[model samples]
Target chain A: MTTEMTHTTASEPVTDRPIMTPAVDVYENQDELLIVADLPGVTSDSLSIDLEDDRLTIYGRRKALCSEDTPVLMGGGRAFDFRRVFTVPEAVDAEKITASLEAGVLQLHLPRHERTKPRRISIRTAG
Target chain B: MWMTWNDFDRHFAAIDTLRRELERSVGGTRQSRRLGRWPEATLVDEGERFVFAVDVPGLTQDDLTIDVHNSTLTVAARRVVNPPEGYATHRSERTGFEWKKSFTLPAKIDGERTAANLEEGVLTISLSKLPEAQPRRISIA
Candidate 1:
């Protein structure tokens, strides 16, 4: 049996780095895996996803765009900064990975490698 | 230099009072401001397991904490705001409210092996059924 272990690390950075906290969903089907991430206030122009080796990274920045009519009693809060990293399994077909964003949710589809697909075997009857 | 000590004390007191009032007004306004409402969540049973979906956009895992105890599940997160330099205010729609939502799970679920994932602002949590909740097959006579 092959055992799979997934580890997640969460921390707070001391430096003046941007903060990104987008929620995500993952689903596995017979042939592929699907990932969805919610990034409200982020536009497509400011979103980016990159894959290197077996790691996938998602980044997005939401610019502050409050209207002139809004009153500014006090100002504080990172406009909108988001970043997430995931380790892809070797069975994933990296070349065919695709991602798209709609209404602030980012969707990613990772197809399984050809060799790892399931195959059926026929039983033989002998006299 | 020729002014009386009483005059100096009065001037300083006036400035101090003004500063105190300014600070009080700022604090009051901030406290009175509304943070906004939380979104609704739904759970459905799909034969094999129970699936829960919550609407919580723009929240990272670091900002969120999930807890399960005695068949109750709670999700809490704080949204931080760090305005940029030279950025001015415009229209505002997104709620700056910190969220803390919870749900009571059914007894049929296996609380120990629950799994959660967040995607596209929707948080989906799955709870597998307990062995007792699963259907059993009886031997034929």
Candidate 2:
């Protein structure tokens, strides 16, 4: 089983605000590893994912678009602020890490280090 | 018999009042809709196309609705709160807001033929570029 460590931090501190809880899914394939995060109401421009010295940080804020002038017939109370961090493993290639956003989902791909990638060695039987 | 001016004024005032209320209710005003905030999402590009996956646990495919228009993709869903009936809740972390998400497609995407599939509560959308958007080789004269 692959072991992982997670840490949470906020780039901009907001006092008395509830912490955002983010759910993540990490997938690995022969070529690279993928990290998918579920962050609703977050746009690509508003999201920030950083990898600093083996620690990967994901942060974002969700703001309400509704105005006071408009009447709210119904509403639900939910937490919007979210922040999560993960300690990347040494097998991940930091330089090649890339991320994208679509449908409120953020995906990060961390390519495996060239040296860590599997290499097939040819075996020759003694004749 | 001619109705008194006072009575006619009252009748007309009642109609005007009803019209004002109808206008206020049906006018082009955006009703504030609050969306339940879930976790953030990450998209990964897999050589052929982009794989968009979201971490949504305890949700089934029937709960999600995905719509694509032009270059915009919208994903909306409702997460029903499953609680024991007549059970008093002390504290709850789950927020029962309807989730609504939208994204603008990049130039390298074929908005017409996009496809989406959900697995294990994670939605994967395959976005491929049109033939024209893809790079082609032209011979130099």
The CA lDDT at A29 in model 1 is 65
Please compute DockQ, using alpha carbons, for every candidate against the native two-chain complex. 0.04, 0.03
lDDT value, candidate 2, whole model: 0.56
Worst 10 residues of 1 chain A by lDDT: A1-10
For all predicted structures, in order, the TM-scores are 0.42, 0.44
C-alpha local distance difference test of each model? 0.58, 0.56
Candidate 1's interface RMSD, please? 19.5
* lDDT tens digits by residue: candidate 2, B1-141: 345798677645644543353333233212111112242243433434544544454456788887766545577867654433433333234344466766544325676778887643446676675565443557779
lDDT of residue A53 for candidate 1: 93
Alpha carbon lDDT at B68, candidate 1: 72
Best by DockQ: 1
Residue A76, candidate 1: C-alpha displacement in angstroms:
5.8
Residues B1-141 of candidate 1 have per-residue lDDT tens digits of: 244688667545644543343344234232122211234244554445656655566666787788877555677767554322333323222444465655554435677888998755556677677776554567779
lDDT minimum window of 10 residues, candidate 1 chain B: B28-37
